[model samples]
Target: MEQWLGSLIKSGKRVVAPVKHDDIVDFAVISSPAQVADDYVQTRLSAKQYVFPKAEVLFSYKKDGKDVTIDDVNTDEFPETVLWKLHPCDVAGLEPLGAIFNWDYKDSLYNARRAKTTLVTFACAASDEYCFCASVGGGPGNTDGSDVQVTMLPDGDALVELISDKGKALLTDDIKGETSSADGIDKEKFIAKVEKKFTVDEIIKKLEGSFSSPIWQEQSDRCLGCGACAYVCPTCACFDIQEDSHLHGGRRVRSWDSCGFSLFTLHTGGYNPRTTQSARWRQRVLHKFSYMPERLHVTGCTGCGRCSRACPVDMNLVEHLTEIASHE
Candidate 1:
């Protein structure tokens, strides 16, 4: 694994992997295998930032008297990147995230980054209380969006599955080991058994008529509206565009936003559509469970449990969704 990572770095690809920082595990660019975190169940944040950054400048502009000049961003300059050690749930999010960016109009910025990025995922050998990937069409060994899938065996050897042409390209002859058949390997025994809480179809069917349900109010009463859930979520693509202007020049920037914020639905006429936290919370759930699946043909969540884990309040998504599914 170290040799392969080193080879990618030597080939000019930016290798980003999970790194431990005190109690927080997050993705960071690494030059050596020693820097990668080994004991983490999940990173504090997903690898989505590499493809879709938290904040990015779309274009720059300059004003000369009455004349305004616009300089479009160069997508050709985006760096080649490899997201290593990502789990199946995190990789699965790329499908929905990409759908949102490409459905209405082709997002050149997102496409550029995504085209240059390679996903190297490690199958989950363990899971925690917050995990529920199996409920949302994903599993510990699922490789929905991974370029390469690496499953570690009990004997310290890894079972490398080349999932795409890009994945095969990353394995050089020097690092390629003797290929062996996985015919008798019980992969299920090596991976975590995340219980399926509620299927996507169940959640979608329940949410179809749950708009006026009082459950939203009951579930969101303790929400702090801090947007921490969206910030850590792998599939949350909501963002706001703003102009950073100076005396003669400025840059148009896109920054992350959240539906959980009270002001997210505020109108320009001082009228707020979602005035309460309950409505905002409801939008978050319905959008992911009902709207995205209906419109994009893909669910907006991968059952990563990052939102529940990042919430300051103990608001578990799996429990909430299960309750919604059972609601009459």
Candidate 2:
């Protein structure tokens, strides 16, 4: 692992990997392989930040007298990068994000970074109670958006599957792995061992008419409106564009926003469509389970379970979904 990471860095490409900061593990740019952590189940934040930044200056402007000069932030400056040690679920999470950004109108900033980034994902060997990857049509060995999928063998070696042209470009003669069909036999078995509590399809079917359900209000009553779910989510694409101005200069910035907050649906005329916590919660649930899947033909929830872990009130998504499913 060290040698492979070092090879990537020595090749003059920026390498981002899971780094340990105290008790938390998150992906960050690493100069050396030693900075990578080994004992992390899932990253605190997904790898989506590389493609879609949390906040960025879109353009800057200056005003003097009556003339205004505008300067756009360069979207083409992204360096060739390798995202290593990402879990399969996180890799699959990027699929929905890419779909939304490229659905009707293409986002040049997102496309530019995605074009330059190569994803190297590690298959999950185990899972926790909060994880429902299989339930959402994903597994430890599922390779949806990964450029290269890597499965750990019993002998401490890796079985590498090159998934795309970007994945193939990073391969070197020193990297030894089988890219043939024989490698999948064991991987399928490994994936078969993974168990999910319930199917996302079942939840989606239940969510079809749940907009007026009383369960949303009951479940969301304790929600602090912290927006942690959207912040950590890999597929949540809501953002707000704002312009910051001084006396003579300013910049237009794009930052992440969340439907969990009341201000998200606020109108300039002092009316908010989603006025109550129940309405906001319903939007969050429906957006992922109903709306996005209906539009993109892909499930918005990746079942990574970060939102459940990060929730201050212990608002478990699986539990709520299961309860909703049981309702008539």
Which candidate number has the best lDDT? Answer: 1
TM-score of each: 0.98, 0.94
Kindly list the per-residue Cα lDDT of model 2 for residues 74-99, writing each as its tens digit. 86677998999888888887889889
TM-score of 2: 0.94
Residue-wise C-alpha lDDT for candidate 1, range 166-206, written one tens digit per residue: 99988878786656677777777888899988899999988
lDDT of 2: 0.85
> What's the residue-level lDDT of 257 in candidate 2?
92
The C-alpha stretches of model 2 lying farther than 4 A from their native spots are 176-185, 188-193
Candidate 1 C-alpha error for residue 198, in Å: 1.3
| Clashing residue pairs for model 2 | none
List runs of model 1 lying over 4 Å from the truth: 177-179
The lDDT per prediction is: 0.91, 0.85
Q: Kindly give the stretch of ten consecutive residues in candidate 1 with the minimal lDDT sum.
A: 176-185
